[model samples]
Target: MTAKVALVTGATQGLGLALVEGLAARMSTEDTVYLTGRDAGRVAQAVEALPAGGARVRGEVLDVAGPHEAGRLAERLAERHGGVDIVFGNAVMRVGPEDDPREIVGAYAEVNNFGTTRLLRAFAPLLRDGGRFLVVASSFGTLNHLAPALHGRFDGLSSLDEVDKQVAVWRDAVADGSARGGDWPGFVNIPSKIGQVAAVRALAGERREADLARDILLAAVCPGMMNTPTSAMWWDVRDAPSPAQAAEVLLDLVFRPVDPAQYGGLVRDGEVLPWR
Candidate 1:
């Protein structure tokens, strides 16, 4: 049997790096895992530091926000390994309350929303049958934080068109300053995550037929609060789990058997959580 191929994005540090290490440790001799980040130097350092194993661990520079880069990576993976068996979309960007609203919104959408979509579009074709796609998501993205109407629209999404429409609404709100209004709550990171969660739901619904035919499973998971640099910027990290602990939970999901019933849902602490 051919060995499995796994890829983790934004894996130079924090939770992403820990995830790469966990995945690498679990791989068989024939398997290959690719660890990617935007910084070549960081990627090289990470690759060198990971524990050596029979499974080949390689590092590459990849910015998930770049569509061209995503496409190229997918193409290269196809050429070398036939297709990918698992993908962990872990790259993200966060902005503080003091930052300019426009910059915050743009960064969130570019890195979290569009970036996730681009990876899905580019790599969906390359995901082999019975493969898994996991997006690192957050509880902040849940419908509970969104306005009732916006929440309804997101919850009602059953296709990619609906998902696109919902994202456009948020984008428009951001442009018009309405996202900062009573209904939308103008936090820099939440809206971006909201868009990501909605897209995952829509993609799961839209791809249901294809997923069934191809045996592909798609899911979004929140690693809970982790004591990472990004989290330190906002919350007190003293109470949170270390990145390595969070990585263990994430890797568990990656290796578990696919369950059709859980498709398109948000998972936290190993259990499926209701989006609303």
Candidate 2:
């Protein structure tokens, strides 16, 4: 049997762990799913707790927020498996209401935007034909939240470099207090989320012509408000679906035949959101 490989980042807890569980349950003995986290002990525990039967579960130490971690993992996976079938950019940084919005933009950019972009840059080439790359993102990732000019600027970007440049522009505005008066969104999370989605769009556009023949798919997916520990920190999730439930939804996209409609879009509950 040809071995199938999947990688889920930040899989030690919450939604990431649930995605790992969902993937493991669907894969056969010949397949493998790598569950990664920053801490070795937690990664091991998460792998051990998975019920036996589906895919072979393995633990890996990974921190997407770290400078060189994503690139290293891509290299290691390429050397060992030649390529990967699924790549989940599930790692994230949570911001609480009390945290100063301006003060946290830099941190959020590092993890939420740059980290995810780095993952795309590294793992995109390693995605096998018909493979999928999906980022666990937010519905707030739409460009409609920005001022018309800003919205147009982001929507017009054709490369990841342009997205990075725009994010730097926002960061500079925040540092100088211009963001307060400028038409920027007050919350740091909005722009960070937008940057993530925009990067996905940019990369997808870059590979569109080539990827069509290969049947590869890539998108930024919103798992909705799941009743996970991370979400409970920021909002009330009493009625939200459990992480496992959300994972099932994500896995549907992961396993389904590629849909041209969803490619490079901000997907939520099986629909591509309008950018405007």
Candidate 3:
């Protein structure tokens, strides 16, 4: 097998950090690893903190939402190593507590959706036939929204229309059909049709990061909920796993590709969790 270089964004903490550790544990020395984040200090710290691995670990400063970072990053790859083999688009902006549902909607679109689109556009040239591109999205982006599972309080989803409304009823436990949460529905289109259903079955938000990095065959791996600062907003789950353990899950996916259908993109409990 041909060895290659990988560039992972948001590698300072949480799930992003896991991707760093996992790749380090899995890749051989001939391969190169670049840990990135907007904060240069975090990047430097993460590089110093990496565990012993066959791959060489370096740090870079990158911002997923801003312009030029992607193109500039690609240029760096070209300068130092000639090309980049993998691009893990994991940089994300955090949301603060707010009542406005629209704010949450806008945040996800700009940060999660548009950010990925931008990076892909800038780095399209760097990715060769066998290069990999992974986006660390949430179940929120999928057809099901994983809304009912654990997104009860995520305001961005509260005002969605159509299909999302149907889900709210079952989740909110309405009394006397009075609609405990609201009179209107937040609509999102997941499981609305055959194609959507297929996508739901195929949505591998987190697992792809650790999988095979080839030309266009990108993969993802979900870190599930972890005990990092990212989970500061949600309080229901107790003592989520550490970034190190989460990294192990991703490493498993890299060394062994778990069928997306079987894993549902969120690998946990030594197996992939089934999407409802």
Scored by CA lDDT, what does every candidate get? 0.81, 0.87, 0.54
Q: What is the C-alpha lDDT profile of model 2 across 8-36, one tens digit per residue?
A: 98788888999899998998889899999
Q: Model 2 compared with the native: what TM-score?
A: 0.95
Give the C-alpha miss distance for residue 83 in model 1, angstroms.
0.5
Q: Count of backbone clashes for each model?
A: 0, 0, 23
Indicate whether candidate 1 or candidate 2 has the larger TM-score: 2
Q: RMSD per prediction, one decimal? A: 1.9, 1.4, 8.5
All candidates' TM-scores? 0.92, 0.95, 0.64
**Which portions of model 3 miss their true places by more than 4 Å?**
1-3, 99-108, 128-130, 146-216, 257-276
Residue-level lDDT of model 3, residues 1-276, one tens digit each, is 556788887778877777877787677888888898888888898788877867888888888756567778788788776766667767766644553334344444344444555565565457554565555544434334544543333223311232234333433332233333443234321212211222222332332443324314344335566676646664544577787776676555445543534332333434443334
Candidate 1 achieves a global lDDT of: 0.81
Ranking 2 against 3 by TM-score, winner: 2
Give the clash count for model 3.
23
Model 1 CA RMSD to the hidden true structure, in angstroms: 1.9
Top-down TM-score ranking: 2, 1, 3
2 against 3, candidate with superior lDDT: 2
Quick one: best TM-score, which candidate? 2
